[model samples]
Target: MNVLLVSRGSTHHGGHDAIHRLAAAATETTGVPVRACFLDGAEPSLHAALDAVPEHCEVLLVATHLPPDRYLDTWIRRAVAHWRSTRGRRARILVAAPLATQPALVTAVGDAITGEHTTLDGNPGPFRSPAWSQITRHRRHVLVCRGPRCTAYGADHVAATLGNRLKEHGLGDDVLVTATGCLFPCNLGPLVVVYPDDTWYEHVDAGLAVRITDEHLRDSMPVDGRRPRDSPPL
Candidate 1:
């Protein structure tokens, strides 16, 4: 099993550490000539990473934390296409979840890579286990939409405020908030979603965010809304 562990520059601290540890273990155990690639500040291209894998090798992508959805999906599709074109089939792509959350972006990446919806647990061999799973099973998730339009409307602050509020509520263990690049309906951002119900909210502000944390997230009440559909495929 020839392994390629690709780490992203933009992932959270915990996720970065976890990927490094996994890379070390995989190299030690398999002795399969593992190569580690760190996507540093948009400088290292995904195409270059794909090209780095040798022909006839069994490739596994260990995405401990992924970049924004726009970049992640484009890269996944390109990688799949490239592998099939050159290697005649898609490599076994295994993705570890992000450090904290379980937003639609995570689902999208998993779907794109594995062509399946199930989450990976334990040592899937050559691939390491996700770090977050050991701490707890049930985790609260907050989705921050930072798509091109949403970022233009100050989505970063929305993500920061939600993280602070979750900490303030002393629900850090139970909650994980993440800022994804986009969630479609760019006009309505900065949008937010809460899972496992997959509740979607539009035009979210600091006050509305706090209400979500208190009324729905903290209290376990359903926010009055239906789940939004995925964006139309590109």
Candidate 2:
């Protein structure tokens, strides 16, 4: 049997790292092949993890979050069903209870608070790291529209590809990429807007998105043919 531990992934790196640690520990303790997967906001999504499972294998999916959520559980069920139908090879899937449902976890938390092994420092220190402040202090911010209509046209793929291109050109630190809802030109999606230059590009596919990152984002050269004239800019 194979095990996949699922977490609601974070935008920040640490949260995902923690999930990896838990998966490693679970494997070490049980000698089971274990992997960590995310529900959203990170790569190796639940579907991706399921795809990696060997065909005809019995698989167990365990949620790593505290306080079980009906929405997440329902989504997992639907995702598992979809995966079974879409993949050429199929695996037997079983949804296990979340880790936090264990009574030992509740006792451990109470013990941590009551046993006085924790500290509550009241210092009003820095909210974030200086390095974080530097990384976010970019000259240009790029917004990719991810509205329902845009998503139908592959906006998510566009955003991921654009982000990769920006990083490849060493512009990721200098450029901030944000995913937004309903940029208001659904027919022209997937749309990408760059600022403070206020340049808007419509119908951006992965290939065109890479070009925009290299030519327009890195070299300050806009592809005139792709821009919409009457579009509002940030």
Candidate 3:
């Protein structure tokens, strides 16, 4: 048997380091092969973890979220099933209950709050800063979804490719890119939403990202069939 600890993943370096450290500690403590996987924003995705599992082994997926995401708890099974069907089942995958469902967390939080932890002595600074107002004006802005489903569907590469293509086309000054969390209708994930036009693109890939950057952003022509027909007014 093996263990895969699943977290929501992090956008920063420290979070990835912490996940590996915890996985290593768990492996040493249990003598079971342990690995870390994420829904988005990092490498070693759930499918990748499954790929590394020994053939026919019983693999346990442990959900490590602190506050508990019910959506994740539900979607995980469907995601794994899809992986299994597409890649051929190599192991028996089982998902453990989320961390929040454990009764011990209540006691843990209560005990933690009792400790005298250090606190800041005073207000850090003014709410507003001059640097914030100094941002360059841009014609269009894009929000790329980095949520679980979108990540699994390859949003990272899409975002990277779009940025690179924009730079190549010398349109970086005219377009701004940002990565955001879950933008649902995950069925059409790897989504990219462009504004002030308010166009939402579905099932975006690296190639499509580049095309969108060239046609919609640079040439000011929206890509055909990106926006859903049934989309409600925003």
lDDT of 3 by residue, 72-117 (tens): 6776786688778878876778888778878888888998899678
lDDT of 2 by residue, 196-222 (tens): 877888888998898888888899888
Lowest-lDDT window of 10 residues in candidate 1? 38-47
| Runs with alpha carbons beyond 4 Å of true place in candidate 2 | 113-116, 122-124, 127-140, 144-161, 179-209, 219-234
Taking all chains together, each candidate's TM-score versus the true structure is 0.43, 0.68, 0.73
Error at 138, model 3, angstroms: 2.4
Top lDDT prediction, candidate number: 3
lDDT (tens digit, per residue) of candidate 1 on 93-183: 5554443355776687787898856767887566556774685644667777755445444455566677788889888878777667557
Clashing pairs in 1: 147-181
Alpha carbon deviation, residue 159, candidate 1 (Å): 1.1
Better of 1 and 3 by TM-score: 3
Model 2: lDDT equals 0.77
Q: Sorted by lDDT, highest first, which candidate order results?
A: 3, 2, 1
The clash numbers for all candidates, in the given order, read 1, 0, 0
